[model samples]
Structures are given as C-alpha cells and as structure tokens.
Target: MKRIPIAAAALILVALGLGLLDLGLLDLGTPDRERFRGMVSPRLQSDKSSDTAPTIQAAGPTYVGRQTCLECHRENHRLHSHHGHATTFRSTKDPEVARRFAGKSYDAGEPFGTYTYHVDDQGLFVRIPDKFGDRPFRLEYALGHRSMTLISLLPDLQSDQDTPRSDRDTVALEHRVSWMASEGQLGKTPGQHDGPPQTAAELFGHRHEGRIMHRCVYCHVTTGEIVGQQIVGLTPNVNCEKCHGSASEHVRQARTMKTPPPFSVGRVDWDAESELQLCGDCHRMPRDITRKQLREYPDLLARFQPVGLLRSECFVQSGGSLKCTTCHNPHQSIDETTETEHEQNCIACHDETTPSTETSRKHTVCPVSPTTGCIACHMPALKLDGLGDGFHDHWIRVRDDK
Candidate 1:
C-alpha cells in the first residue's frame, strides 16, 4: 500500500470540498449520505480518533441491533426516547404519504377517491394486502427506514409494490413503471420509472422480499439481515446494534458492566476499529467482487464497495487531506436520519471557516440556503425507471444534471 504525501492529500481534500474532483462537470446535489452533504445536518467527524488501545483478538457473534441489544439496557431507550430512528413500524401519520400514494394521479386507474382500502401491496417482511377495488393491491410499510432517529417516506412507488400468493405458496412478483432517482445525484430527480425490463434480474428482481443485500437493506432499514427460516423471511427494523457495534456484549456490559472491563460499550474509544466497524460496515458501499449470500443474507464485510472512495487518491494525497471522518459522522442524522446525513455533513466542513475541518481551511463560497446545499449543485437527483426510481448516483462527481 503506497502512502499519500501529507501536502497533496490536503489539496485534494479541499478540492473535494469545492466539488473540484470531477472538474465541475457533474450535478452535486444527490444527497447520498455515504459521500457528500445534504442530509440537513452537521458533518459527522469521520476523522481518526487519537485514542489508542490494545486490539481485541476475538471476533464476536453476528449481531442484529434489535434482539441482541434491546433485551439488556431498557434505560438507554430513555436517551433514545427522543430519537427518530428509535421510532419504526407504526401507522402512517403523515398525510403526505397518503397524497404521494393516493394523489399520484397516474392513469394507472386505481380510483383514488371512490375507493376503500385503495392500496395494499408489499412490505420488507412478507405481507398480503387487499385492494378496495379492481386495481391490484399494494402493501405499504407505514414506515420505510428510520434515520435521524425518525421515519422517512419511500419516494419510489415501486419500493413498496408487491403481488399476491396463490395456492402453491407462489407469489407472482410484478414489475412496473415508476419515477426512480439515484442515491446521490438530483438532476431533475430523473424519472426512474423509465427503464426496460429486459433482464430477469431487473424485471423480477424485487417481486418478493428480493434478497435484501448491500443495495437493498440500507434504504429500508438499518442493520438488516436474513433470520428465521431462510425462505419464509426477514426481520426489518431500526436495530440498535447497527451503531453501537453488535450490542450483544454492549448489552451484557450494560447489565453487569463487563464487556470492556472498566469501559463498557457506551464509552466509545474513537481510536479502535469498533467505531469504524459498525459504520464502515455500511457507509463503505459494495465491492465489484463480494461474498456469497447464505440463505439470501449477505456478508456485509465481504461486500463493502466504498463507492466513490478512492484509496489511491487518499494515500497519494497529504496526510490531513481527508479522513473517512471528514465527511461522515456515524452518530448523526440527515433529512432527519441519524445513520448518516450527507447534505448537512458538507456544511460542517464547507462553511466560511470550516471549524470542524481537520486538514485545511476553505474560503466560504456558496450561500447557506437549501438550494446552495452541497448536494443541491453536485449530487443532483436523476429520476429513471431503474433500481432506485429517483436515486442520486454515488459517484461523487461535479457535472451537469444530465
């Protein structure tokens, strides 16, 4: 592994902050939390912590945040009582969700007004909903994914779409047109519902609980995986361990105060991989090559893809150029999501006198307005009838919104 010179790395870090890496050619408003700003929060100190401790030799059991952690400390829930991610699986309170669904006046003809139970389709977990009228039913998870410790609405109509199961326990998954957007860019929020269903993977890929792996789980829920009977399932929720590092021990530590001897899981040693592991576990993206899915569950570590992350660039640049922590803070939220918030993450380091910045200082340029959000100009959303109906690309470039 080649190392980056401390000086050049510093320049690139500033360049990235100015949306100069891609030469000012790509729309920067995608709001992809993994990379740049726009989650509407402060930057999450992704910088390496100065603390150092002996590395733990053992690898613990695989943990899912809910079952593994919730059982132990019922008190922390008090602290999180105010957290939004802490809230998941409830009936819809936002009338906006109703409008987004019912008011979507598309000519698909489902009778928005004169209908009872107008929609009933699919959920992250298996579900069957009955339609009020002749239109095919669609199931809706009252809540999509929790971040900012709160609930976010699934914008892509197809994300919650599902079909019916017949006598043989077989459900014919249906694919349809939808306005999709990339995870990072926002160019006109491209109509993601405009692609051809030529391939089997593309057409029937999400008919059912279509193997929620790398690209799937993060969007729906934090810390998701296959549990229960492989074919019959998935337990989706804003699990606790997703952030605190497999709370099994953390929980045990809380009960008896013993996991890390004197310092329990709550005392995060920013120096250890513990902080990075839980986060890099997800923010790191998928690799071109990855682990095999066991019973539809993926080995997150084996599949990390750090999308726009260029290790070579980081290594060759100056030491303070940029650290993973520079743009992301695992403990924060965006657009109300706590897992990560890109749009606001940038503001932390891009402001007039970037206070939280570790590498260098930048002269403030853009006005502090919603439209001037880092992502508003760089990662602009592009809508297409693709995997993410209206996703922002994760490429982290500076270009036109086309």
Candidate 2:
C-alpha cells in the first residue's frame, strides 16, 4: 500500500495498541505506562489504607424512652394508651389498683386460710394468717387492669444467693392470690391450684423469679432490662419501642436534620411470617407448643390466636396472605367493636367471584356459604375456663352443624 501520512500512521498504531490492551493481549508495565493507566482509571487513585484498615463504623442505637416517641406519634400514643397491653403492668401506687382493691377481702377456709386485702396510705397490703398470727405483706405492683383478672406482685421471697435486697437487687414475684372480675371474687392464681396448708414461708415457695422475669415480665412490660438480679429502667406497660426497635439513632438523625438510614430504628422489611413471629414472641404459637401439650391444653388455644390461626385451613390455603393486622388493629383494644369489620376482611378474599373468572383472579369464593357472615360459624367464640368471657377462636374452619 502507498505510504500513509505521518499523523494517520500514528493514529492507526494507537488504536491498534488500545484494541490489543482491551483484548488482554498486551501488558504495559513500564513506569510511564502505569502512571498513564492511573490517570485513566479512577479506581487506581483510591486510598490503599481503605483496603487494609479496619472500619470504624458507629455503634447501634439504644432505646430512647416512649415519651420521646410520643413527641411525634401522639394519636398512636393516645390509641395505644387505651389498649389492654398498655395497662398490663402497673405500680401498686396507681389509683386504679387502689380502686379495684378498695375494701375488698378474700377469705379461704381451713387448709388454704384467709387473707384480708386493704389499701391504705401505707400501701396495698394483704393480712395473711400464719402460725405467729396475721402478718402483712406489702404489694408493690399490680398485673392486669381487672377487665378479666388482677394479680399482685410481691417482693421476691427467694433472692439469688446472698444478694442483699437493695432497690437495684429487688425482683417482684407473682402472688398466689388473684381476683377474677368475671366471677367478682378472689381465687387461687390461675396456674396455682387449691391445696393443703403449708408454712407461711412455703406459701410462695413455688415462685421462680428469674424464670418469671425472663419469660413473663419481659413481654408484659415495655422495656424490661434485667441487669444481674435487678430490673433496670423498665416501663410498666408495652409502648412504642416494644414493637419498633430502639429509636436513639432515628431521633438523633431527626435532631441533626439528616435522613435516617433504612432500618435505623427497627426492621422495616418484615414479611408475613416475621410479622406473625413478632406477635408470636409473646402470644405463643403452634411452633412453641408440642402435640402432647396441645392435646392437654386445647382450651389454651383461645389465648394464643397465632397458634389457632396457624392451625386454620384459611391460613394454610392463603399461603400467608392473611396476617394478624388483616382483621385486628394492634393500635386499638381487642373487643366487639372490631367483630363487625371482620366480615369485610373475610369477603375481600372469599367473595362471590371465582379465581378462574376475570373479575377476581387471585382468590376463591367461600365454598360453603358465601353470603353468610364468616365469624360466627367459622370462628365461633370459645370460652376459656379462667380467662373470663369467650374469645373468638382464630381458627377459621367449617362447622358441621352450621
């Protein structure tokens, strides 16, 4: 070929070199070449210390109190304040506790003995008859709002090894006596049975304070932090942070005028199963029960809606399309007010339209009776023996008679 111009020849050589480099057929490692490579590639300029040095990321957030949460969520706070969960645990000094126990005395015959309940300026006291005579035990806390049952919290009779009873070391034990509002009478605590008399010291001997603190108190109260033998900084009732994780980081971000990162306060991407598990942590689910336990305590299913709902065909068929929030609002009290609204929720999935049809492609109509209300027949109210009124069974199933 004819000799090309000097500029055109230089351009052709540069393009050929670049093409060979791109094809990994050339290795240019000279000092001048490496410096040129650094100029072209931005990643080459990245600090080498970044690759070897340890990351100094900030620590996870801590729990800021519920009052901090109430600053922004007043309506939710107001609605939640009226929920049964909000009043599950209360200091004995609360006026409501005093009103419930005012002038009330419970007397048991022979073996069990008699006890007189009285609330005075001194505090709530139960005078129990022992060998020495009637002795007074001061009640420190009250469990339940008396809508169903109310029980007292007594000072821990059994402390861990020689730990002195300091304010920091104090633990509350569930008392043996409980008031059942449905019957308008006091009875032996729900789990405890009526038995022969024992020494005054042995009366609350069955109390497992540590186990109760770990299993029961942790769920009943909002934030129960047990440091050693002491419960440090516990909120008496369930509050916002109980569901949403600690919001210290979130609050800090808001104060600093910065957008908080994802899941800065709590997990935001909870699937249906995880949401159920969050509620199940306290409510108890089928996975928490054994077959033998289920058989022995079938009536307890009323208290555990998650377990009952998991057993239902509706839940199994829907592939987790239904959740607790689908029919019940966690922000509100659980009562008859929500009962009428459940039919609408049921109809959303089980209406007249068939899955094969164009109108409703995803759900099937109720095979038994589409027109009838879903609750009464499918989820009939089952009375829990000691739990007062009937609790509608969350197990959605067909009733033979209906």
Candidate 3:
C-alpha cells in the first residue's frame, strides 16, 4: 500500500482531532475565560492607570469609576444613550411604568393566556392561573429581580414538568410582554435541553452562546475589570472604552491634551472590513469555521463566533465570500448617517423570489416581477412587549427558501 504524504497525514490528524468531542486542543473545554499567562504574551501592559491599584467599593464590587473616563469624554457619554447598550436594561421608578400589561392575559387561549405580570416598587414577577377558569389571569408580583426579564413555557410545554433533570437551555425568557401578545407560541421550561428547547430558537438552530459569555462585556457594560477575585457588571450598557482602547493611554493623553486613536475623529478611508473590525470584534455573527475554510489560527474560539457555521445555509459554493460587516455598520448607526436604520443587506446583491416554495417557505412573489426589500426579507418587525421593534432574525438568510 502507498503511504500518504506527510502533509496529507498531518491534515488528516488535525481533522480527526477537530471532529472529536470536547477536544482539549481546540477550546480547552471552557469558552468563558482563558488563563492569561498561558496564552497572552507576558509583555505586561505597564500602562495601568494610577500607580496605585483601585480601592474596593462598598456597594458590592469596586467599580472602575466610569466617571474617570467621562472627565475627558463628555461627548462619548452623550452617544451612549442612543445605543442598545445604554438603557438596554433600565430600572424605572413609576408604578405607571408597570401598567402596560396590568392584568396581562385577557384570554387563556391567547398563547400565554393565564399568566399575569405587573411591576410595582418591588420589581417584575408573575401571577399564574390556579385553574383554567381562574380569572383567566391572576394578579402577582414580579419576582427574582424586578427589572429582570425571564422567558417561561406555557402549561403544555413547561420543561420543568416534562423534560428530564439532565438538561437546561430548553427554556424561554418568561414574563416579558412578548408572552401575552405573541400570536406565535412562546415560553419554555428550565430543564428540557434536548437539543435546543425553545421552538423559535430550534428553528433558527442556536445563537452563539459566547454572546452570553464574557464577550458580551464589550457591548453591555461601560467598564469591565477581570481581576483574580471576581467578574462583574450588567448587560445592555455600553461603558467608556467601547470606543477608546484600554483607557490608560487616553487617560495619559488627557493630562497633556493629546488625542487618542479612537476619539481622534479624523477622516480616514478604508474598506468595510478595515472599518468594521473595530466593532465586529464583538458584534459579528460568530460561526465556527473549520480548518478547511479558515487559514489563520482558528483556535481562537472566544473572540470569533464562527459566522460560517452560524449562517452556513446562506452560503452557496457559487457565491463569493460574504463577510457580515460588509453591509452592517458597527461604530455609528447607518441610519444616523443616511437616515435609514436597516441598511439594504439583501438588495445590494440579489432580488430573490419565493412563491414556488413550500408552505413554510412560500412567499407571494409578484407574477410580472419579483422584488422584496431587505427589511422585509431580513429584519421582519417583531412585536415584543407592547412595542414593535425590527428584530433582524440573526439567522441571516438570503431568502425564505434558505
């Protein structure tokens, strides 16, 4: 028998390793935090602000004082309010703020028909039906954290009652306005992690969990410090350094009135990839590309969500490589620049058709000519809470056919 060449043998070995379950070589199992000394070069970034370390705070954890950066960055703080990260999770004071869904369920047949949720000074919780006829909804206080939102399953699909003890993630965020108003099904049980538990999420495969993990910090919190003792902060709040790097040099430059790389505000010309990489570092649709597709150190799993794997169906061998940030802007809203929130992600390439597809994929394509806008095609408006927001289905599809 002829022996395989060395390169071919090495390729086979790597492929076999990658395909294995929980390979120690790939992610080392945990995706949250990597041991710094193990991977990061020891060229210590000596520019840590303040020769003395931070003094711990009494509130809980010692915050790195977002005000410190705000001293030099008044404008940066102004822009934070518009982004999703700013008030993504706000704690409101007025009781009327909770009145939107006062008695919640008007009818039991209305999907989550029997659950009533209201918010008072205590925060958000729920009241469930004692019987099918129990007022169709019962009054209850919002438990856990008041501002905290959760997804729960309706009676029929509750995983805590149905699924085995061995699983989770087979769940939904309950008590949100989506549950009562949704014409579509909603809610989930906590222990039914058979594949993906939520019907909607399963249909879309899975969202990269890395977003729930550490990387969410770049977008969510205004500040983060990964000390040996603890990890802390909340999401949907963009802190200071999202635009500025590390804040050490920017802090130093503040003393001398020098400008930092990020806040420089100089006009520079570059391709979409060059520009988007700054924000795409955290925002890209992470798909795990295999060794065959990527040439660089694909081993860096925490930072790069394998966009290729997440939206593989969108790609055909015939089409060119579509990097996501090609259409989406990371730094500022394209709408702010052009007065359009949803950029034309679909039309920039193809005007796809649908009428001929199955019941699920069927679309009413015009007989004379077929045309669908990117907003309708991708970020179809999803009505959650009483508000209607254009939830761009992160599924990132070319058409309903995919």
Candidate 4:
C-alpha cells in the first residue's frame, strides 16, 4: 500500500469525522452546527423569553368603553354596529326590545296559565296569572338583536338588595318566554323545550335565574368585569376592544404620540394555534364542548361555526391557511350576498383545473360544476330548529347525499 499524500490523508480524516458526527458517534461542537440547532429548535429560547415576560399586575388598565374607541375608529365602529354581535346584549331601552314586546302576550294555557308581555314607560313587564295569582316580573335586558328568536332577560330577584349601588349586584335572570321573529310570535326559549311548568305551583315558584350576567354576558358584551357575583363595569356590546383585548394601553400610547405604538392586543402576529384559540374562545370550538353535549344539543352546533370548521377535512388539509377571517371581516357585518366571493375562497385551495388522465396523482374535483358556487353544496345552509334561522355550516365537506 503506497503512502497516501498528506492533503489526501487530511481530506479522508475530515470525511470520517463528519460521518461519525452524523451517526452521533462523535461530537464536533462546531459553532455552525450550534447555530443550526438554535435555528431548528427555538422552543428553548421561546420558553426562556415567555418565562421572563411581564405578567398582569394588580389593578391593571380599566375599561374606557366603546365610545372612546369610536373617537378614533369611526368607520370600523359604524360597520361593527351593524353586526349581530354588537347588538346581542342590550338594555330594555333598546328600540328593538320595545318592538318585540309591543302588544305581544303569550297565553301559556294549563299549569303556566296566561302570561302577558307588555312594554310601557316603566319598561318591559311579564304579567303571569296562575292559581298562585298575578305576578309581574320586570324585564331588564334583551339577549338578541337580528336573530329570529330573542331571549328576554329579567332582573335577578335573588341579587336584588337595598345595599349601596357599588355593593349591589347587577344580575339578569332568563325568562322562559322568548320572542320568535320568524313566526312573529312568542314561544318557549331555546333549551327550555320541556313545555313550561308542569303544575300551577311550579309555574309560580319557578325562578329561572340562569345567571345571564356571569355565565354568558362576557361573550355578548365587551370588557365585562364581574366581581363576586356583581357586575362592576360592563360595556354591553361587542366593541373594538373585545377581539383586540383591553385597549387601555393602546389608548394611553395614542394620546401621548402622533404615531402611537402598534397595538399588541390580539395582534395578527399570533401563531395559527393562537389565532384559532382567540376566535374559539367565543365561537365554541371542539375544546369548548364535549362529544356527548354536542350530540344531545345538535341544534346548538349550528351557532358554533369554529367547532364545525375545525372538524372539516378541508380545514385539516389546509394546514392553517383557512380561518374565520379568511372569509369574514371581524370589524364588519358578514356580507350574505358574497356567494361568488365565497366560491373564490374555496377555489383558492381546490383549483378548477381539470386533472390529466395520464397523471398518477389527481386532486379531488367538485362533483357538481366546478366553476359554479361551491358553498351551496359543500356548506349548505342548515336551519337551526332552536333559532329558526338558516346558518351556513362552516364544515366544508362533499354532500353527495344531499
């Protein structure tokens, strides 16, 4: 064996060392390798950064209300006002509430007996007459604006006290009778399908305190602060800060500088999972509801678009491209007349190009006309029995059975 050249021998040694390193049998500890490792595995750095991030201190920024936001974002405020979310929770003073209860009386015969819904200068009153005698409950809030059905919210009798206003709890009790806009009539409220009270005594004693303020008010209202059963501060509308988080810091920044710092609350810089969770908080994602609850309350699923969309094969395959904001502008009311626009969103992933017969790999084509609207078939409008409104299912799937 002839002795190899020094240069050749050096090259062989380097290659052998690299091979051993690749096989994890040797450690080079090179700066380049360390940099590559840092780039690929950033969780270690992220964990450290997150650990040191400033947490919410005691008595943070206070809610300034939607009017403060409207001063700067007039156009956005105007558009959001038309959204159903903005009008979901309202005081009895709202004109829509008056329209709903105007001369409307639901005569719930038998055990419940006759119940009259009346709106006057004193506000909404539900006069219930049974074997126990006539008792009128004051309705304080309305739970919906544009939906076919609107749930009435009465003042919580349990929470009613002669204590100081600051000490008193402002709570809402759900009324059994709900206004149905579609049929232009009053019927049993959603989830109360058991057909009123069983007996006359039960009707009189029924105190359906669903805890509307604590249980569901947070979603409907913006910056709702509940402290020990009492609602301290609440802006009864889905305002600018609701999705964007508390705008107190942003407002402070804006006041001092001509060009304020970028508002960090609910920033678009969030990761896909973070973005999903943000919307999922209110939209009722899969994590929010159990399989048993979903099966039992199938009608409730119609309202939970995020839950349905997350379950869709399209959403799974899209790998984070598809989101609520993909088709909807959160600041504005959803445009129902955007059939062509909606079809374009579907076409973004599902190209209309015909597959070649010779090609081994082929994409799934729309069984119906590819050029036409895809949503009509894939995400058909499903009528919710509870609300009596047709909600387009966000779950994008082939519905050949339909």
Best by lDDT: 2
List the lowest-lDDT window of 10 residues for candidate 3.
12-21
Q: What order do you get sorting by lDDT, best first?
A: 2, 4, 3, 1
TM-score of 3: 0.42
TM-score preference between candidates 1 and 2, better one: 2
lDDT per residue, candidate 3, 1-402, as tens digits? Answer: 122232331221111111111321122222321222111211122323335664331112123345675676566555544544444333323243245444454333323334565555555444444322222221222211113233221121323455443222222122323322233322332112233122332211112122232333333344543222122353224544443333444455467766543322222322323333444443442322345334442222223333432443443321334445545433344335431434444433443443333322323233432444445554344433322243344434454432
Please write out the lDDT profile of model 2 over residues 243-338, one tens digit for every residue.
Answer: 665667667666777554444123344457666766776676665555564566465566678878887777887767678988877778765356
Cand. 1 Cα-lDDT? 0.33
| Model 3 lDDT at residue 348 | 36
TM-score of 1: 0.41
| Winner on lDDT (1 vs 4) | 4
The residue-level lDDT of candidate 1 at 320 comes to 32
lDDT of 4 by residue, 1-402 (tens): 122232331221111111112222111112132232222232233345655765452234445677788888898778887887778777775777777776777776654656676777877776664433345556666777654223333333334466534223333334557777666677766543244333322332222222323446666777566554444576787776655655676687688998875553334455555556656666656655555644664544656788778878877765665688777877777654378877777665566463434422234667667777687787887777656665777777776556
Q: Which of the two, 2 or 4, has more lDDT? A: 2
The lowest-lDDT stretch of 10 consecutive residues in candidate 4 is: 12-21
* Model 2 steric clash total: 0
Q: Candidate 4, which segments miss by more than 4 Å at Cα? A: 1-59, 130-132, 148-172, 193-213, 225-230, 265-269, 293-300, 335-337, 352-367
